[model samples]
Target: MTSFLPTDEEREFIEVAKGFALEKIRPIAREVEDNRIVNDKMVKELEELGFLSREMPEEWEGLELPLISQAQILQALSYGDLAVIQGLPGAGDAASFIRLQKDHPILSLHKEELIQSNKTIALLDLLEVANSQITIEKTENGWMIDGVSQPIRLASFADYVIVAAKDNEGVPVVLWVDIYQDQVKVDSGDYRLGLLASGTGKIIFDQVQISKQLALAEAEDAVKLMADTRNRIRVLQAAKQVGLMEAALDYATEYTAGRKAFGQEIAKFQGVSFRIADMAMETRIAAHLVWEAALAVDGGKNTAAGSSIRALYRAHRSLRFVTDSAVQLLGGHGYVQEYPVEKWMRDAQAQVTLYGRERELLIERGEQILSGAIGVTV
Candidate 1:
């Protein structure tokens, strides 16, 4: 079946985002992979190019494009490099969440910082330090935060920190604190198996004073917000992986066809050709679901049920196919860092864990949707 191709106008914008990633981000993919710094330079450039401004309102300095546009941008950017895409100078796609603030201080600070950032990035808010273990306390000056946050994406490079803390009422909420002046950020230097450019550091908010606008109306809402953000990230990231996996397949196909093996070119061998076929087919399906979810998001269906299904589609099913099959086609080279497949494989691992682990998210999302259950949103 013929897929829905993008409009010339849409493609034009995509090309702009693509060009930035290809020219600016691709060159640094290796270095970013080798280094711990989530260098914000490329991200800043992309932000300026309007890469992160997907679906944002023009009035708020965002493109207010569409959710599909947002997904496409991330997918293309990931093809060049996800680390650079995420370690963007400020924040992307975070404008809406920031504007949702009724009295959420953290969001207020974030919005202000984003303006200063020139819409360079969409930073991860520091809600639930260490995924809901650490706590933030309201203080006389403003609000005092205590505890360490793990995997602060581009923490060292982030212009602002979106913090999650509890007030005197024990209400879980978000706190937006700027790292440059208000708080101190520490680099963990702990490297991961993949997705390297992200600072992925430990951030400590030691008695940091947060103003009134930084706090969530209800602290308990932090968990919901986290779930929502993770879902969005997962679905969009899946779209990117689809692009990367296809590129890997192309490399395998071209290489195997041209290289001579036992009797003839390896592409003549069913072993080589079949693997490529599977990867290609699986990639198409994944792309569909990724787009479906993006459209769902565009349709305003950001429920856990929807998000979890999308997460399951991408993480457990689509991601698994892309990784395993890509490795199969590459033989030894797939496992070696010399090829980008190895990096792609490692990066794919993050999809499983991010948002919620597949099984956990599956059970939660499945049971609810199957049984027609719904969680109350604040």
Candidate 2:
């Protein structure tokens, strides 16, 4: 019964986002990446457009758009530049947690600041419990967070951080930390790959003591919340990847159609045309998977988590293929800095690394299916 067609309001929002992305975001993408920051003016514009608060609850002066609507809008915006969309100042990935637990006591305390200020929140998700350097220990009255986190988007400028990790005893917990009060240090790295405009950096927590009041959830509640939050994040991120894929696909198609090689347009050649067809197929597949995942999450289905994992894994795979195909199709011009295909290819790779490993996601989905936690249809 799920409909693929977007509602009138959703279509309007997508059109507006698409226009702003091409007109405003695409033009300054290089400048933003070069400066390693999204300027305040652009951030204000995004805020005015309600892009920054799309996932937040209406009670907190946010749009509280459904996952499907948000996914389409985000895909449209990110079509211009994924890094710029990521770098925009706002709640960042923590928006998913806020949307899931809108009325939590800890979140309620910060509701005013979140609604009134442009302060951003970075999420350090250590729930994977593999290849993580961050260590969490339960204390007498609270918990102590130590070690440095991997490069997380928005870490460089985040005013707050949400940690979703298991303690030394392996009890899952979610905690919020005030970056300034806790003296969390942002370790900026020499990132040359992609997402340069994103506030990508490591956060150092040297024996940071988080009181019990800051613990958003613990034990079973924390596990459930983290699962739902991660699913939502995966779906949204997959939507963004789909956007980048479409951008690369379209750019490559146009380049091939115009650039002459032998005696005519290169697109006339089978090699070039075949690759374009493949890129288009990959993009369409990724888009459909992301949309399905978004709808599953919005519907609060039991299979939502598995669907999200499948969507993201496919998105990661297809994004890399499509972007690389774009570069390959453009030949020499694709490798040069003057063209945007190279940047898109780099961004696609960086995005895949940051979100989740493709193999891991696939394995997780497989396990979910075998365990009967999610049906094969998902």
Candidate 3:
């Protein structure tokens, strides 16, 4: 991330995470993807090791580490396998948004359980107008939520799903629904291009009755919460992008350096070396921006249209370029699954499309800048 190096504790944590990745995730990466399931034992180990509690409150048995530390942990874990990292037991950014709202009704009662159990909470972003398929209605006893969520990440495995919707007056509201409730139905599993092991799926609420205890009242600063959640998810995704680019670059570099062409190493060729140099430059820039975004978030700065968003968009493009170049450098070998380059490209594409597409971020940031709402440097 910036020029700054990791502290002793951070370095130790990264090493432990790397060891786990090598020992647990790397061996099972192919098996997990083929079976479309993550290793339960490995996930349990991460939970017990406190890797899942990075951003939680300490009072509830959370680690509450700095954002940069959390970013680094996610990045290191992602280098092992993006799908496995996604499927890990932890309160993702969605749950983090609810947890930050001190007055959340449901979270108030179940906060401790959430932290102690390391339960994953899926978020359905009904705020996306293009995907505003869900709606909520207030009932006499609780709330009746009816609609379908399209391919929520980890939906099949989530202990809870925090739904974002609008009320009668079009005010945004969030609902905390129990995944096992009778009214909740998982329509189908996703067979996407990548991240199949992350348990992506569609969920349908057929007149689902949410108990009052499970409903989170609209927070006073719901807008801010939405912005912060978006920024944080982008930051986390950016971290994953950094790992992907770095791994791909390293793989390609090593391959070119050792492979002989025209009676000489491929890396010795000016064209080959220059392409690798470009990939390295982009990867470095992406990594630095990710850390800068994390730092900005940790510093309590707004990053909706700022560094966090910029970093996310830049990383998306950079990762895509790096992975593509890596595959090209590997030539025929990269197109096959025998090597990791193909898989790295797949993972990079997934990250590029997830959360928000690179184009969407660019357009939003462009509009904001042109409107004078945010400076160009932001």
Best by TM-score: 2
Candidate 2 lDDT, 83-188, residue by residue in tens: 9998888788898999889999999999998888867999998987587888989999999999989899999889999999999999999999999964579998
In model 2, the Cα lDDT at residue 240 comes to 94
Ranking by TM-score: 2, 3, 1
Best by lDDT: 2
Candidate numbers, best lDDT first, in rank order: 2, 3, 1
Clashes of each: 20, 0, 0
Q: List per-candidate RMSD values in Å.
A: 4.3, 1.2, 2.5
lDDT of 1 at 270: 84
lDDT of 3 by residue, 1-378 (tens): 355478998999998887787788777888888877777788788887788777666666778777788878877877777777776655666646754664565676877777666677788766544545776777777678888877767777787888877754567767788888888888645566777677777888889887766656564455557766767777877887787787788889999999999999999999999999999999999888888888887777644348888889889889889999999999999999888888878877765665678778877788778877656786
Instruction: State each model's CA lDDT, in order.
Output: 0.61, 0.90, 0.77
lDDT: worst 10-residue window of model 1: 121-130
Q: Please give the RMSD of candidate 2 to the true structure.
A: 1.2
Candidate 3 colliding pairs: none
Give the range of the ten consecutive residues with the poorest summed lDDT in model 2: 181-190
Alpha-carbon error at 195 in model 3, in Å?
0.9
Error of 2 at 298 (Å): 0.9
